[model samples]
Target chain A: MSITIYVPADAAALALGADAVAAAITREAARRGMDIRLVRNGSRGMFWLEPLVEVATARGRMAYGPVAAGDVCGLFDADFAGGGVHPLLLGFTEDLSWLRQQRRLACRRIGVIDPRSLADYKAHGGGEGLRRSRSLAPAEIVSAVTASGLRGRGGAAFPTGIKWKTVLDTAASQKYIVCNADEGDSGTFSDRLLMEGDPFQLLEGMAIAGLAVGATQGYIYVRSEYPHAIEALNRAIEGARDWLGNGPGKFTIEVRKGAGSYVCGEETAMLESIEGRRGIVRAKPPLPAISGLFGQPTVINNVITFASVPDIFAQGADIYSGMGCNRSRGTLPFQLAGNIRFGGLVEVPFGLKLRDLLYDFGGGSRSGRPLRAVQVGGPLGAYLPESQFNTVLDYEAFAAIGAGLGHGGIVAFDDTVDMAKQARYAMKFCAIESCGKCTPCRIGSTRGVEVIDRIGAGQAGQIALLRELCDTMTHGSLCAMGSMTPYPVLSALNHFPEDFA
Target chain B: MENLPAIERTIEAIVAAKQSLPGALLPILHEIQDGLGYIPSESVPRIAKALNLSRAEVHGVITYYQHFRQIPPGRHVLRVCCAEACQAVGGEALAEHARLRLQGSDLTLEPVYCLGLCACGPALQIDETTLHARVTPQKFDALVDALEVDP
Candidate 1:
């Protein structure tokens, strides 16, 4: 019998030399003349143990990881191909504590199967949602999603079904389904992971959206930085083209690459970019639902939002809605990144406390220092002090505390970090990436940077000036680029004022 | 002057290839850049003419996006992730180290917001292909050394 071994080809794993490790394994296997089939799978989100090699043992798939090219020969010598003993042996992959605890819905197929394999995706419960939706009326399909209590996983927390209903009601000749795969947020990789890992899930989800909204065309606007994801998405779309729909005006998905612009992550700006223009934020008298994507009624959602559709349709809406806490229903794929020892993707029910995510799952700072702050959401999110660590990871809960569960990306900072510098960076990032659409975002951010610098240099009254500037940017700005830039700026001031000194 | 016709041909081919698609300018510009290392000022009029838009409109789009470079880059592109996630894990310091190491070298150092390797950052992408995570200053130096020796 031929032995099977698994290694992740996820970008994060590849970054840590998974490709080199895979090459080493192949070389070693060839040298030993062992009959083995090596499979390059997606990440399980346990990034700390990436290049996580698994062997199909009699008991199950045994794991080994953080594996390097140097350790390949030793593993071979220990007969690791047959699940033999080795220092890196991690027993069955699914039995690992990090993965076993959480409720993974959108990320269900992420690390499990060959991302590019259509057959593999089908075997792992892929097409059930689209197939089920094929039988239902569009309104009934919409109702299923509405009943699921599914909100936009793209940090806005707007009801997903409501958005679809508006687009459905709006009569247009050409409607579009735009997947915001421009996962430009710093601490977030769920979109990237889903795109590169289980891309079929996302494609299926988008196809389902097309079915519900009566839209025939779909476009995924991915950032240029994610070349791997872009490639994976294009491949998935091509492979799943036949599986998408059979009739005339069937769902067709096109992958559009975003030139490096963080502001384009904004829905309106994304639409503008799709139109081959400067990614300036559009004024919202007409929401994207009413007039979006070539002046057609469009449904623009994040990658995770679309990916979650298949399961919501596969399993009943009630099953997903039953999982999370009040209001914020279903599991969230919280990206645990930065400074933390065990940082990776942790998808749990919405009510998981910040404390548990930070200490329990993240295992504190990677440098073994005390963690002082964590920036929830993207660069535009607030910096929460250690005192607020007990706050629930729910939309309303986070909102009540002036923090946001934006895209559920939690980037932890150790005590050594200077909050004042972080605040400056927030301003700087805003200044650089601001679409220059409105005065408050474009000019205010530049001024805010200067004010912070003045305060840092012990100039009196600059702090108050900075606050006033943040307020203007918060309210006066046309979009979130200017509006939410103040979240990090003020949060650092309110929570860690001493860093300013 | 020598590269004028070649640049025109590149822009023309790019626009011709992608102009059929809706909102074809960004993709055309991207393809032109990929074909020719940067989007030259001379190519703007060509692109505008091809797309039936004003030169200023094409110019505005080019200037708005940071990814569309007007000038050619160095031999090796060292893109460091300067986002909040990487910054939390000593990415700022690592960026500074990268800058100093490649100060006089024929290598370009640019700041990228994020590269989706947030969990194992400080992340760095070499030449738009090879992404390195958990990159300490030492690792960055070694990477630079290897690149320098090879080039």
Candidate 2:
């Protein structure tokens, strides 16, 4: 019998030298004349233990990780293929407290299966949602999704069903499904993880969306930064051709790569970029549901938003809706990043307190210094102080405190950070990334940097000027780029006044 | 200047292949950049003509995206993450180290907002193919040394 060994091929895992570890394992297996089936699976979101090598044992998948190429020789000596005890051993992969605590509804298949294998994906309850959708009417499918209470995971938090219903109601000979995979948010990687890990699920979700909304053609606008995800999605589309386009509805999916533009993550900007224009945000009177993508009713959703659809159909809607609190239903895949220890993905119900996620799962700052501030959502999110650490992760809870759980990315910063510098960066980033169509974002951002500089130089009156500028940018700007730039700047000013002084 | 015609031919072939794609400009630009280190300024007219758009429209798009460079890059492209996540973990210092190290070298160093390695940052990419996480000044030097030795 051949022994099975798992190695993660996730971009993060690869960045951490998983390839070298896998090569060393293969070389050792070949030299020892041992039969071994090495599977390059997706990451299980436990990044600190990456290049997390797992072997299928009589018990379960025994894990060893943070492994290096040099450790492979000693591993072979210890009969690691037979689940031998090694110093790097982490016991069972599931038994890890970090993974065991959370609810992983949408991300269930991520690190568990071979991403390239359709057979493996199907075996692990992959196509059940699409299968269920195939038997239902368009309206019925829409109702199921609406009942599931799934909202857009793309920071906007718009109800997925309402968006779908509008598209379904809108009369169009040509409807389109656009998956927003252009996740340029600084602290977010859930979109990349899902697209690279279980691409078929996203495809399935898109197909179901097409069936529900009367859209036949779909486009996944992926960022150029995520080359691994693009390759995985392209491969998945090719492999799942029989199931996707051959049916009566005839759904076909195309993967489109984005240029390096942060504004392109915006739906209107994404639509413009898809049409081969500058990623300028369009004013939203004729919301995307009415006139989108070549002047047709298009269902534009984030990668995770679409990825969450399949499970809603596979399991009953109540199962998903029952988990989360308030209007925010289902699990959100929270990415713990930056200066935090045990940094990885955690999918849980919406109401998990921010402190628990920061300290309990993250284990505090990597530098062992007191964590001073945490930025949730993305670059556009607020720079939350330690005082607000007790706030829950729900959308309403965050919104109540003038913050957002945008894409569920929490970037931690230790006491070494300068909040004033961070605030300046927010303005600087806006200046660099703004689409130039809007004035408040384009000119105000540049002015913001100058104001911050003056304030930092002990120009006392500039603080009032900066606040006035933020107010103008907040109200006068066309899109979130200009409008939400104030979130970080204001939050920093409000929370950490000493940094400015 | 010697490879001007060859560059034109490459751009022509790329535009011809990808012109029919929906919102074909980005895809064509990506291919041209991938094939050639940068999208040549002269190739803009050809792309504009092929895509049936005005030269200014094409030029505007080319310049709008930071990815589409007008001039050719160095022998290697090094993108260091300068985003909030990476910045939280001394990414700014790593970027500074990269800048000082590659000042007069045959390497082009650019600031990327994020590389999705937020957890294990400070992250960087070499030539857009290889990504490195938790990169310190010392580790960055070693990686650069390896690149220099090989290239």
lDDT of 1: 0.91
Query: B-chain TM-score, every candidate?
Result: 0.95, 0.96
lDDT measured at residue A416 in model 2 versus the true structure, 0 to 100: 93
- Each prediction's Cα RMSD? 1.3, 0.9
For model 1, residues A268-326, the per-residue Cα lDDT tens digits are: 99999999999999999698999999999999999999998888888889867898888
Estimate candidate 1's RMSD in Å: 1.3
TM-score of each: 0.98, 0.99
Regions more than 4 Å wrong, model 2: none
The sequence of per-residue lDDT tens digits that candidate 1 reaches over residues B17-78 is 88889898998888988888888888888788878999999999998898999998898889
Looking at model 2, residue B111 earns an lDDT score of 92
The DockQ figures for the candidates are 0.88, 0.90
